[model samples]
Target: MDSLTQTIYECLFGAEYYEVNPASDDNTKAADVLRALFSANEGGEHLKKSVHDIVGERGWTENLAKAILGGIENALKQGAQMGKTMADASEKAIAEAVGFARDHPYFCALIAVGVLAILMPWVLEALGFAELGPVEGSFAAWWQSTYRGYVTKDSLFAFFQRLGMVWH
Candidate 1:
């Protein structure tokens, strides 16, 4: 199975990926030692036995030296896998975010508004947009105009009525 599928399977099913350590050169195998250190009341005896099995499988006399070398090789391979996994995961996450934005435009607009509010000052100064407003007919006066041009004052009452502010 692919490494990502194997990892997900282990996470979801609590299944052992190996009865003993696989002879794979993945540095993450050494991470068991770190996990043993941080996990309270935990022992890495299983991992030690696995390493010993690895050494014996190779007919190595010195367990510690073999384990160290194997760990370095394991770490190197795992590091490459980790980098690829991160890049792939980031792409998927971005695609998911785009999907979410498509499904919920109002929520996305609110988020955009909040971000704009926070960055408005820097953006205004950088783009020199602060000097423009609809008061004298700048883009800032966007609320007063449409793509077809400015709305006439005759529609003011109609606009208020559309907003549920009708006066009898």
Candidate 2:
């Protein structure tokens, strides 16, 4: 049976591919360590054992395994560091987007009121079948209609009517 570490490592990085050249001092084994870190199934003990098995299977003497373990450790360590960087970048992007929206108050207000206008039908229904007039030319009504038209091909009036609250 394969060692648990080997199993976990394979689960993580088995999909990675690298070309090896027999004549050169290629460090492709780092690929295995990285894959192990990225795998969802890995655990600490399993990873340590897997590294031992991998180096052992590669026919590295004890001295060589000790030497190569340093490089392997560095590779997996860097992969984790890179993952942190990517997550930080994503968080920063969302923060910037929110800041931009806040800085553009008029655009944000327009969106908020438009959403409110969209919900007006439900508001009226809750107020007990109030006789709301036709939205043929009023500014709020016209804006909603034009906006809905541009977005959904349904006239704003028609969209509100489908909510069973707003009239034409």
Candidate 3:
């Protein structure tokens, strides 16, 4: 078996077990070690303890430990770079959207009005101002009747009077 696999076997199963077994094939040894680690009762706890022992007993050299740490640091740096790239892309998209809206105020206003018109009935129903009941004819006829009922000259005058009061 390889030195790393031998060390792992010794760490998990003890030196006696490693010497007694002496597996010729590295793959078979590794699989056997995996089976022993997972199939045992309290396997997770055993695995944790074995890993602690392996580190504490200096199963790996200083250079090997440093290499593992370097790999982790590199992975973290790459993740941070990826996050920065995504943030920059999102900022660019938002800036473009704002620029478009600023350059086409009339178009934006028309779009807003269209959206409001489509949502008016649902808004009115939600506010307990009207019910979306069965219509006699088309949707346009129903909307016209509903609009006339709520938007009379008296209501318009009342609204303007309230606005004037607010301004004053």
TM-scores, all models, native as reference: 0.26, 0.26, 0.25
- Candidate 1, run of 10 with poorest lDDT: 159-168
Tens-place lDDT per residue, model 2, 29-141, is: 54444444444253557767775665456655543343345444444444444344334554587799799888997666556645755666455334232245334454435
Candidate 1 Cα outliers beyond 4 Å, as residue runs: 1-82, 121-168
Check candidate 2 and list the clashing pairs: 145-156
Model 2 residue 55 lDDT score: 49
The CA lDDT of each predicted structure is 0.42, 0.46, 0.46
lDDT (10s digit) by residue, model 1, range 47-100: 456545544454433433344444434443454233333345545877999999
User: By TM-score, highest first, what's the ranking?
Assistant: 1, 2, 3
RMSD of 2: 15.8
Pick by lDDT: 1 or 3, better one: 3
RMSD of each: 18.9, 15.8, 23.2
Q: Which candidate is the best by TM-score?
A: 1
Single out the weakest 10-residue window by summed lDDT for candidate 3: 159-168
Colliding pairs, model 3? none
